[model samples]
Target: MPESLMMAFSWLDWLALGWFFACWAWYYEYSRRRQRSKRCLAGVMHGYRYDWMRRLLGREARIADATIMTHLERNGAFFASSTLLILAALFGLMGTTERALLVLADLPFAASSPSRLGLELKLLLLIGLFIYAFFTFTWSMRQYNFCAILIGSAPAADEKDSTPGLRKMFAIQAANVIDLAANQFNYGLRAYYFGLALLAWFLHPLAFILATAGVVGVLFRREFHSKTLKALAAGRDLDITFRGILQHEETTSESLKSQNK
Candidate 1:
């Protein structure tokens, strides 16, 4: 490669790498916060009586409420915005705009002979972006469909006559819907971040690999060590505690009433 070409490629490569790392950090932090909030909320719902947890993390947990419509709105916005950004990036990568502007202004990069290596790199990035976009959109659509089912089926009538199994089923469905929505949002956001990294690759191929690694690192933290995961586990514990307490209270009340009578 010519010295100038090499320099251009090197600069782009570094930019892509930096972007990838930055995105990874962003996601890691977000997931950590989310996990913490989830745990605190779970504690509150299950009557864990953790005043400090509530004081420090209550708002976050509230944000994670499985039924919150805001979560849905956020997901929708992410999908929409990501779709637009990705489309723009794709068009830019295709040089369509550059070609159109050729009549108006002479741009040096636009006029240079296309490099086989550069063209191949661009193609690879395009394919990756397309795959990520498709998966993110499709998954989000499926989650939205699941949410619709949940909205339609959720309890509207008195449950006095409903069997335990029926109630359990409803709870399961609700949980499933929440899980699906969360996953879709996570995947979609990651795709958007990756698209940015792909754009960075217009500068260099190594940048793409760096960005990929950074993203992977963030994902690892979220999946394994994030506060959100801890909170989720804690929430389960709180649920059991609350159920036990409720059962005990009912039993004690029944006995006391029988004796009084």
Candidate 2:
């Protein structure tokens, strides 16, 4: 591209966008690996979820498992609806982007009014994030449905007892399905978290950078150092443990209890 086209926005704007993506990717990879071995929130919950399913082998009534899955599916459904609405609103802005750019041009800290192409690219970036979230959320819903099916199909304790090692295999498999669904849902929610930082771009590139840093800091603290992680770890009985960032099934269980009462 020629300098004329490139100069439609300041170098700062491009740098800020680049920096945000860099940080986003770094945090994702770091948290993913750390979750495997560390006592992070997600890892700990995985332990509990596994134990929960494992214990169900001995139970005749599995109302608790159904309620837990319902809560999770509801959570995913809410985000899926949100993403669809946001994407619709974003696309509606496409025709009026120039006018929005006009408004942006009047802002006190505006760098340079970007070209029509530039604004369209930014809009596409936002749309893309929401689209990703939508798929992730819906997929999570499907996975939760699969989890319910797995729970329903579980063999009775006496049946498993006769099979020696079969109970452990069944428990691990069931927990793995549930954990994978929750993981995708977390990724969708993380996109929303990063999307807030991206919104600062509409204000100013400097604001964008600061917002990205702030959001990342908040996320890092919640994932690695939050009191929630400690609480979950404290609640650990049996072999359950934790590792990182995301929360676990205890909240669902509590919510279920509240609703029942």
Candidate 3:
């Protein structure tokens, strides 16, 4: 609302900013909806996670499972720590606004020099993005810790007291937990992609708009149409047969239990 801040951005800049946020929000919803009936990375990986939990229940030795979980937690920790460092650097940069403005002015592609307030606002936007990422990453870590607890409590394959129905339910619930944690991690990573695109805003609004669109396109390809997704989808088809075996076991166990009672 400051006069200088008002002068920093033209109508085109405002339009570009609006476009950036709209694209981000709209793509998020689109991906979420598309995954329900489509073959996306998130949907395919979730199927694999369910398969993993089912296999985990069948194994008595789970040290490898625990190690995998630890590695995932470490990844979340690394990202959260990195986000904090970047935020610190951005905050420090605020103290040298005059020098930053000079650097921008020297750039061949710089559209216009921003006022100190404008520069600060840009930094603030970056700060907000990273703050959201930090929250998501940290939350993901906590969820993974919860998953560890679930892993610890999971029923072994040979345990007579655990019925097949109970085991199946446990695997489904635990897989859901893992999927939730993964969703948080994905959200945090998406924030990083957007933050990188937002860097173009310092040069020109049009550049920022184009960069944001580019990031969204890349995300879309990787999520829904990449080689990785195709590979996973192929594997998921095999998983269907694997799940069928588990269902058969469940049904046989129930029949035996009913006969005994």
Candidate 4:
């Protein structure tokens, strides 16, 4: 809209910010489609999650599984609480927006001092990002709660033979729930990652562009080529024979259970 509303950022600055968000959206879609087949960590982890649910079928003691779910919930809770704290700090800083900008303006490298409206605009953007992250983390926590419930209701080892169809169905559902929660937690983390880039806007538009690119590049490399991915992939036997068969057998467990009779 109005230039005043736009703040210190020019059209190019706004476009760079848009580019930052666009990359996030693009990666999300690409990951959704290719995760199962690709070499990305997400795909590998998805396989593990699926395999985990299948093994739950053979296990009698579930305390370990419940413990894992509790850890996931705790992670989500930590991020959700952290986001709220940041949001509160943002509101507090909003009152001194102009005063803070004046201090920055004194610095030689600091870009132009923003108007009050401009300062407010930037603070509002920060607040919005935190709010988004808060919601994503909280939702992830809820999904983890649901995952716990699913685990509790999951079929037992002996019961797996009796109701193979139901076991497979529950296994798939549990894996999906866990995957969805993990995805949401990741989304919140992405928001935090991009928020680092947004901070560069306070310095200068060019810094903003460079910072955004840096953030995207860092994230891209981690997802596709990180040493962690390589380490995770290194368990080729587990990856191929165990996790792979775990997934395929779960699909056929329903029919095979009947054929055994």
Q: Who wins the TM-score comparison?
A: 3
Per-residue lDDT tens digits for candidate 2, residues 85-170, read 99999999998987988988898886565577778878889999999999999999999999999989898766734464788888
lDDT tens readout by residue for model 3, 1-261: 777667777888888889999999999999888764439998888788888999999999999999999999999999999999999999999999999999998988977756677778889999999999999999999999999999999998799999989988998999999988998999999999999999999998889999999999999999999999999898888778787999999999999999999
lDDT of 3: 0.91
lDDT of 2: 0.86
lDDT of 1 by residue, 25-57 (tens): 776576546643434332223233233222222
Predicted structure 2: clash tally:
10
Question: What local distance difference test score does each model get?
Answer: 0.56, 0.86, 0.91, 0.83
TM-scores vs. true structure, each candidate:
0.55, 0.85, 0.90, 0.87
RMSD of 2: 9.7
Query: Which is better, 3 or 4, measured by lDDT?
Result: 3
- Candidate 4: misplaced stretches above 4 Å? 6-8, 236-239, 242-261
Candidate 3 Cα outliers beyond 4 Å, as residue runs? 1-5, 241-261
Error at 11, model 2, angstroms: 1.6
lDDT of 2 at 119: 81
Give the per-residue lDDT digits (tens) of candidate 4, residues 61-130: 9999999999999999998998988998999999887688787688676566556676677789889988
Supply every candidate's count of residue pairs whose N, Cα or C atoms clash at under 3 angstroms.
9, 10, 0, 0
Error of 1 at 76 (Å): 2.5
Error of 2 at 25 (Å): 1.0
